[model samples]
Target: MIRAILLGLAALACLAGAAGLWLTRAHPVEAARFEGLTGDAEAGQTLFTAAGCASCHHAPDAEGDARLVLAGGQRFPSEFGTFVAPNISPDPDAGIGGWSLTDFASAVIRGVSPEGAHYYPAFPYTAYTRLEDQDVADLWAFLQTLPESDAQSIPHEVAFPFNIRRAVGAWKLLYLRNEWIRPAESTELERGRTLVEALAHCGECHTPRDALGGLRTGAWLAGAPNPSGDGTIPSLRPEDLDWSASDIAYYLESGFTPDFDSAGGHMAAVVANFAQLTAADREAVAAYVKALPPE
Candidate 1:
């Protein structure tokens, strides 16, 4: 009886070890190709604004209210747990000042950090992955140009298993698709598609969730409830609203809905970021999104 029990225990241990090995070994392949690209500070500025980096990381209550400051104390709550945004200022000790361009690219595109830990999807790297190599490099350069902050980042208050970074390898295996955006046959529309995929990240808030909390592919950008602890983010479905392409473009750039009311919730921040984009790019996003089939 003792021998049988020991044998069963050994088998379970072996199985667990094998699973762990499989999961961790699946770390994303290193693609340092982006390191060769020359970054444009001008383009980076636009991308930063389009990506809304300041909304979560900058200290909204700071004395000077500087948009460049990275106080790193904002808390984002979700179904899993609360994730505090980190300080990305040029601070070598407290922020990402020490990060190489490759490190930044990996975090934005592959969802892995400089410490080789997986960032929770709540960081929105899922949408960021669509960014082009040059854009990622430019954004990194722009971040490095910011004033470094001494404020340390707060740890995420996620529960067990969720706090374990190794488990995230499995999550990435299940949901992350490491592919570049392909251009369509239409030049104008294809440019719009690329801009939407990279900058607008429309799918992040609009797509429905799956059983494991991953985005549902077929329902991309159809509309989902906001997970940002504010009010619900409404559907962008054409059938749900009478908004035209120009109306959507105007709203994105100005935070006004078709009803002439000011936008609220997280979308207000998104519109604030969109406001910095060029009229042409904003129009591209509007055209693509408005053309999406109704849910």
Candidate 2:
């Protein structure tokens, strides 16, 4: 009887190990989807700005033309830990200079690194997963045009099991749905949806998150506690904003509220970036925000 009990325990152990492996497997985007696609750097420039790539990857305090340099080392503190952004510059040794278009697309849209490891959600590839194929190709072309940086990536300051990058695969499995929060019936609204949901990743900040760090999709843009712990991120729902579409568009372009108060803190940089976009794009974003369900 004791021998049979030992054999049963061994069987359970093997089953548990198999379950773990299946749960943690990396699922990268297939390479075949990118065949024959050519990147357009000029078009990519617009997508890059909308995606806010430089906002996290650029050297802190870099000003003027220096902001274009992608020597990354910005620290973001969260419930998980402090996540240090990596150098995404064209440096052959320290950055992604050697990566192919497939490598880039997989990392951006699927959160799978070139080494076939899962990237932490701090990179925000969850929203980026919705990016159109051509947009990803265009962004790849634009990245190659940037100046190279030799800065080595700073490792994240996570503790225990959280530091295990493979564990992120489970997190992705739970949270990585590519569905849009809101549907659009018009072309302009569709453009706005792409900009808001895919490129801008606005929901990453505005939507509340669950205890395990998965976004609370039911809340959508109903505002969240600032991870920085200063205050709420402010709901973008129509009732909370209480502004006309034009008012929101003006705020995005000029950083000024309807009351004429200038935007401060992190929003200042966001306004600066949005200012580079076309007037119609800003209007579309505003229209989309106004169309959101009330909190």
Candidate 3:
């Protein structure tokens, strides 16, 4: 009886040790690829708008050009909890002004902060993870040009276990891949794949996730229940859309379908972001979606 009891305790310890090892695994890809690359602030600014940095980081109700100041107080309500955006402005004290390009790139690309802690995926670094090294440098430089606000970062309100940021490392290990979730078919799709999967992060909203909050890549962009709102996020498979490439591109440009139906819900903000992209980029995205095999 004593021997059996001792073996049981030892087994439990081994199990706990293995679990800890899995949970603490890190995604430590090198950010030094951006090192020695000089960024063009003008180009970075364009990428910034494309990446929709202002959508969350901009101060509430900041209209027109005032959106350039990233004060980061916007609140995002989700099933997990309410998330508050953080300051990414250039202020040395309250913003990223003091951070090296390496520091900024590390967080944006790998979701690892300068302090080496795992950042909550709410920051959308998973999509940013696919950004080109040059783009990262340019984006960081452009961020430096933005006006800084000293607004205090608001804490995200989440329940127990979810509140533990360290656990995010495990989640990243499971879901945070830096490659295409769906295989690309043609060269034409390569550009759109980069835009849709990387900067736009359309899948982050459209793709259904498991209970653990990892994206259901098998469904790809087949839609999910909206986490921030009370409706379903419609799927984007070609059969789901059934529209020609021109139709998709036009809707992206004007937010109006060929049938005169307008974009609504969270898609309004997404449409606004798409409207800012170049005409060719919109066409490319539409082409990519049009080329998809319907589910």
TM-score on alpha carbons, each prediction: 0.88, 0.97, 0.91
Model 1 per-residue lDDT tens digits across residues 121-209: 88777778777788888888788777889899989999986888777778888877745333445655666776666565667777778
Model 3: lowest-lDDT 10 consecutive positions: 25-34
Clashing residue pairs found in predicted model 2: none
Best by TM-score: 2
Q: What's model 1's TM-score?
A: 0.88
Ranking by TM-score: 2, 3, 1
Q: Residues 1-295, candidate 2, lDDT per residue (tens digit)?
A: 9999999999999998889888888887788989779999999999999889998899989988888889999888898999999999999889999999999999999999999999989898999999889999999999999999999999989998798887898898899988888988788889899989999899988899999999999889889998877788988887777989999899999999999999876778788889999999999998898788775
Q: Which numbered prediction scores highest in lDDT against the true structure?
A: 2
Candidate 2: RMSD to truth: 1.2
Off by over 4 Å in 2: none
Per-model C-alpha RMSD: 2.9, 1.2, 2.3
| Count of backbone collisions in candidate 1 | 1
**For residues 148-191, what per-residue lDDT tens digits would candidate 3 score against the true structure?**
88987778888897998778987887878888765677666887
What is the lDDT for 279 in model 2?
Answer: 94
Evaluated at residue 265, the lDDT of candidate 3 is 74
lDDT of 1 at 261: 97
